[model samples]
Target: MTIPLVRVHGVDDVRLDNIDKPRTAPGDVLIEVLLCGICGSDLGYIGMGGLGMTHPMPLGHELVGSVAEVGERVSHLQIGDRVVVNPMAGGNSIGNGGTEGAFSPYLLVRNVAADERAVIKIPDGLSVDQAAMVEPLSVALHGCRQGNAKAGDKVVIFGAGPIGLCVALCLNYLGVERLVIVDQSSHRLAAAESIGAVPFKAGSNNLGEFLIQQHGQSELMGMPVPSSDIYIEATGAKPVFEQIMNTAKTGARVVVLGLHKQSVPLDLANVLLRELNIVGSMAYSDEFPAVIEMLTGGKIDLQPIISHRFPLSQFSEAIAQASEPDEAIKVLIDCQC
Candidate 1:
């Protein structure tokens, strides 16, 4: 049987194509996709052609679904179980150049095991939309953990996009009282304000002075600097990174969560002089359950972060919506629709 699935044929080329539904193996589980969220990386993938694959690559990783079929060897999962998958783990990665992607009517998760925990069951009372958010939220949580965020710390996040906003949510949940979000878009800045973050327009004024105003000032190499404890780089813009390095306080930790296509020049002398710790956060690591718990406990409200939803049939429209960073954040594709 064939089903509608989204595939990236080449650069600036993606389409809804009818593809054969994957057959479940002995250790595999079949999932009927419910929703999938578009990532900023998806646009990058579209621009750079497929994920360096010879064949058309499947797109989408942040997804939630119901278990349509369970393999005989899959003891942990059962048919009809509502779940979210960790695409980075196991051989059954949906999307990321995998044979099957979440932007389809169904997905095949391979190699289920007791220890892997690749497929996580969503507890009752968590809506499918909330469940779909696990992947990206996990990414945000991982970013926070990388920054070693703590209570009472003043944090500044660059980029008020989905990940940045989610990072703000995570920081708040972790009890970081003073939080500021910087973005170029007024629309997204307003969204940041809605979630209790101080919205600082990207180029409105000197970021160093603004940070000092919000987080107080400290001396770095005998010069005044913003006393923010942590800075999260989520915009992937070279200038933002440069700004962070130039203005960050001594002993500050900079967590980079965004994908930078080109290598940006680094000032090693400044990093050494300021004693700054720069770390990179990729995908996620064991943060899914924490994000799920926060969502289940209602500690974070994801509704405001979500800006658009499109049905699977209208994936192109969804992609177009997501491409406009000024207007959209956390655009989701309803697979079941």
Candidate 2:
């Protein structure tokens, strides 16, 4: 039997092709993909023709699925069990280089048995669609954890994209005193506001002035400029970088979550003068189960952020929608639909 899958051949080249169904090895397991999200990095890979990827890469990491066939040696997972995959653990991370991604009808989990480290069983009452979000939520949770966000601290997140909104939601759940999100798009900023974040239009109001008006004078700057306890950069834009450096308060924790495509000059003097602590967050590390608990317990709501959905066959349209910040927030592909 042939399975249909999405493959990227080169820059701006994505195709739905039929390939042979993968055979489950003695210790392997096969999963039927239910839903997969189009991430910002996925768009980067598609646009650059596998920019940082191996050729003919299958591109999907945020995925949820069910066990179709458990290999002879596998003991933990049973057939028909719903699961949210942690693609980072196993060497064969679906959609990355080591293994084929969930873009296909089926995925082969090589050698790793179903466990908390590799996969987390979706709790009762959580829909598969909601489960598909665990991966990105974990990413956001990790960033918040890195920033050491605490109760009563003011947080200013630059960018209202999916990651930024997720970070905002996480911070809100953590009991931050003030949560503000800045973005150029009113559409995207509206999504941020829906989750209780104060949204600011970047171009309309001067960020520093707006912050100062909303909050108060920066202790370090001693001027009418906003200074936040925590500053998160999620836009990956050069100007936002400068804004963060200029507006951050002394001793502020700056967490960078966006993947900047180009290099930007850093203001080392500002860092030295203010004694700012800057940190970079990557994918995630051991934060999945906490995110799941937050979702199941109703501490965080991700439903509002999912702006659009497309069938697996319409992946191109999904990508296009995800690419437009004005059109969508979190675009998902219904693999089984």
Candidate 3:
């Protein structure tokens, strides 16, 4: 049977074309894609047009699939095995295993060794859509690891988007004493509160004064809020990034997990004055294997993140959902259709 694929042929358009099903190349594996989660980078590529990202490329990096065929040289993966693609597979950074980008109905594993390389198998009870989120979830995990959140440290996240929420979720698992999530969106802030974090709605005139007067205490968490020992900036907006820089407490570790516009102004005196240590987290390392384990082990519940799904034919519709404010988080495309 000829497998149909939805390919991005241009800057802002996609085409549904019938392409031949991939064959089992010497060292490659053919996968039947189950679900591909829409990521922030995907929209950046589309919305930025030519300047936003590279052209004539598949945009998705968060993906999951099942093995349809495996090459003779491929020893580990066989036909009918469920799997998920790791985006860092080809990078020098960690967690860069598996295929290039898995956005099509079928994808090809590249020139890496199969036995020691390629995607990880999904255990029973983990749905394909949940498996698809391993990429972003790994990002959150890396942020948590970088922040070094201990059992009783105060952690504050700047954004309540998928990445921020994921970081909050993982930090809770790490036994952090208090999780303070800062966001401007009422909806996103509410969602953060639902998952054990004391949600702070920023963008208010009296936000700083209110927090100061109350002494960072939250009735929801039933305790005096700890000073932010570590801060994770998940939203890269210029003003928001500035707010994060100015507001971080002295002698704290700040991890920049969000992607910003081009660049922004920074107060050098603050860093020098406070002895703040700042670091930039590019992408995932070899964290997908652990993410797969976390998913299968049920350490984190990803169900809340995946708020919408669409068939492959509605690629445009799926991408559009990402910008809608009322839509919860992480809309996915079911490639099986």
Candidate 4:
């Protein structure tokens, strides 16, 4: 049968064309995608070409799908079972700096003998769109887990993008009392506020001073205390790293969740003398189930985030729509159409 899934034919070029539906490999399952969320990595690779891509590539990882077929060795799943595919698995390869996890239309989790380990079951009642959010939410959850949030702790999340907002929401779930989100985009900052976090514009002259005066009260060592007990950096901006350091109170913990190409300066002294703990969070480990439960329990604002949708045939248009200001928080492609 002809399968309809979007493919990145070239840099900045996505085309929707009829391709053969997949069949199960030795340890594989063919999934009909239900929903998919485009990620910044996808955009970056598509716009830059082969920079973070493997040849014979597909570019979506945040997704919900159902088993169309299962291989003889795949006993845990069967046809028609809905699932969220976690293509980000562990293996060493050239693309993506020797990582085996992936984003694709139909993913194959090759094992030791070209085996597979990329499928995770999804719960009922959670929409496909929400399932598509699992990866990003998992990223947020992973970072918050590293922060070790405690009740009454404060968290400052930089970048009001989906990742940032997800971090804030996850922090709320983790019992943080004071959640501060920093973003320069009025649209995204408004999103952070809509979800009950106090939003501040980054890059403002008075940004640090404003936060210090309002929330920097607890004195860890007479260092004007701290505002965010945990600071989550999600903007990936080089300068925001400096801001995260300057704004953090004594003995604060910082988690870096953003991705950028250039290296930024660091303050090892502050981290040393003040007992600041700086941690870097990569993707996720095994947090999809909890994220799905969070979605089912109404802990996240996902529907409003999915501001745009398009038929698979209009893939180019969908990408264009996602690029505009006040644009899509999540954009989906209806592959069956």
Candidate 5:
């Protein structure tokens, strides 16, 4: 019983391979993967060699699937139940080098009864594709939470990628009316605009002037600056962080969600002078259920951010499409296809 999966072998190398199917244990639950999203971190891993493992490591964490086999000891879940998995669960690390990832026909959820956050049943009426988006949306929601984003705060996001767009959706759902998204792609900007976020092209105009016009203006050291209350740095580009630090008004909170592979020089002096609150957001914590509730209640629509879809067999093509920020926003892989 062999199953096909995607893994990273070495630098600039990622491909599908066949491995022995996992056997279900008494405390484990098996899931037949329905959909998995290609994350930017997956691409970063490919470019930077691998997932820092001696052997080929499985890749992909943003996923949702149906329960295929429930172990005898697992009473909370039943076969055929649709669920979203928390990859960071202790003793059941999926898609992050602990166990087999979701980019396959089946995934074994170990220690089902031990951790409550391990597997969550997807509520009725949520589409399968949208359910697959829960993981990333949780990440976006965590970023917003780290920034302590609240209602009536003027927010500016420095990227229009999946996380950036999802952050906009989360902020909007939280009753934040004024939101602006900056990106280099018109297509992604259009997607952001479709989600009720004001879109500004990254390099086409002066972002500081535009931000002042949209969010209002304030003075830092007697110099005019954008008065946005919150600034989320979702773009991993070094210059984007510098730009945010340069223009963030006094008392503004900046949430760093992007993964910066190389070291980024920060202006500590400006940060101190302006009294900026710069915080970093890791994966997620206690955000899955909240995001799911928002989805269940129709608080936000993730459908607009879904830019492309491909079958598991076409995984390479999907990776290529996902790498192009100008062409795609969120690329999903249909594992059950």
Candidate 6:
């Protein structure tokens, strides 16, 4: 038997091809992918061919699936059980670094019994779409954890994209006193507003000035400008990074969640003077269960952020839609459809 899968051959060159169905080895698990989300990093890989990819690469990481076959040694999961896959287990993250991903009819979870972090069973009441979102929400949760956002803290997120919106939602759920989201897209800002974040148009006004006018100046001693307790740079835009670095409050925790395509010069003096705690967050580890719990408990809603869905065969169109910041928030690929 063969399976249909999507792979990137070159820049802007993604194609669907058929390959042999993976044979179930002892201790392996076969998953029938249900849903997968197209992330910004996937777009980057599609557009640039490889940030470091030396060969054709599979694309997609945010995914949920059901077990189709379980190896003899795989005792934790049985056929027909729904699960959220952890792509990063054993340094073999799906859709990244040459690992084949969930953008296919099936996926083989190799050596599942060996890695305790292999997969998490989705709790009841969470739809497959919601379960598919666990990966990105885990990313947002990790970023929030890095920032150390606490109750009554004022937070500013510099991007209203999916990750940014997720960050806003996580911060709000953490009992943030005030949450502001900055983005140039009205559609995205509106989405952010719907989630209880105060949205600010990035180009219409200076971010610092707008925050001061809306939230009033910061009262922290020795701080020269109005600022938020936590500043999250989620846009990966160099200018946005520079802007936040220059205007963030003294002793603020700056969380970097977005993947920067290129290195941008940082104002070391400002960083040193303000004593900003710049934290870099990578893909999640140990945060998936918390995100799932939050979803199950109604602490956060991811449905609204999923603005578009496309069948796996329409991945090109899905990628195009995901590339448009004004038109889509989180674009999903319905593998089971």
Highest-scoring model, lDDT: 5
List model 6 lDDT by residue over 1-337, tens digit each: 8777888888889887777888888878889999999988888887887556776788778899999999898888888889998898855678886457788979887878788478678877888878988898889999999988888888899999998998888888888858888999999999999889999998896767788875568643565577678889998888888888778777889898988879989778778878889989998879988988888987777766999999988888888899999899999888865
lDDT of 5 by residue, 1-337 (tens): 8989899899989989999999999888889999999988888878876768898888888989999998888888988899999998746668777657889989888888777578889988888877988999999999999999999999999999999999999999999999999998999999999999999998899999999999999999899999999999998889999999899999999999998767999778998999999999998989999999889897777778998999999999999999998899899999977
Query: If candidate 2 were superposed on the true structure by all CA atoms, what would the RMSD be?
Result: 1.7
How far in Å is the alpha carbon of 90 misplaced in model 6?
2.3
- In what order do the candidates fall by TM-score, top score first? 1, 5, 6, 2, 4, 3
Residue pairs with backbone overlap in model 4:
87-102, 88-101, 89-101, 109-116, 110-115, 111-114, 111-115
Instruction: Point to the candidate with the largest TM-score.
Output: 1
Flag regions of model 6 displaced more than 4 Å: 51-54, 219-223
Higher TM-score: candidate 4 or 5? 5
Residue runs of model 5 more than 4 Å from their true location after superposition: none
The per-model lDDT (C-alpha) reads 0.89, 0.83, 0.70, 0.70, 0.90, 0.84
How far does residue 164 in candidate 1 sit from its true spot (Å)? 0.5
All-Cα superposition RMSD per candidate: 1.1, 1.7, 4.7, 3.2, 1.2, 1.6
Which candidate do you rate higher for TM-score, 2 or 4?
2
Residue 14 miss distance in model 4 (angstroms): 3.6
Note the residue pairs that clash in candidate 6.
none
Q: TM-scores, in order shown?
A: 0.98, 0.95, 0.86, 0.88, 0.97, 0.96
The weakest ten consecutive residues by lDDT in model 3 span 90-99
- Report the number of backbone clashes for model 4: 7
Candidate 1 per-residue C-alpha lDDT over 25-121 given as tens digits, one digit per residue, 9 for 90 to 100:
8888888999999988778878888888898888889999999998888888888889999987786556787777889989888877643477889
Off by over 4 Å in 3: 50-55, 91-101, 112-117, 209-226
Candidate 3's residue-wise lDDT over 1-337, tens digit each? Answer: 6765554555676555666666666776777788888777667655544232343444556788888877777777778988876655633111122223455678766532444445677887888767888888889989888877688877778888888988887887778847788887787877888888887877666544444443353321243322467889888877767765665556668888999877887778878865678887777667777777777776777766678898888877887887774565788888777
The alpha-carbon deviation from the true structure for residue 35 of candidate 2, after best TM-score superposition, in angstroms, is: 0.8
Per-residue error for 296 in candidate 1, Å, reads 0.9
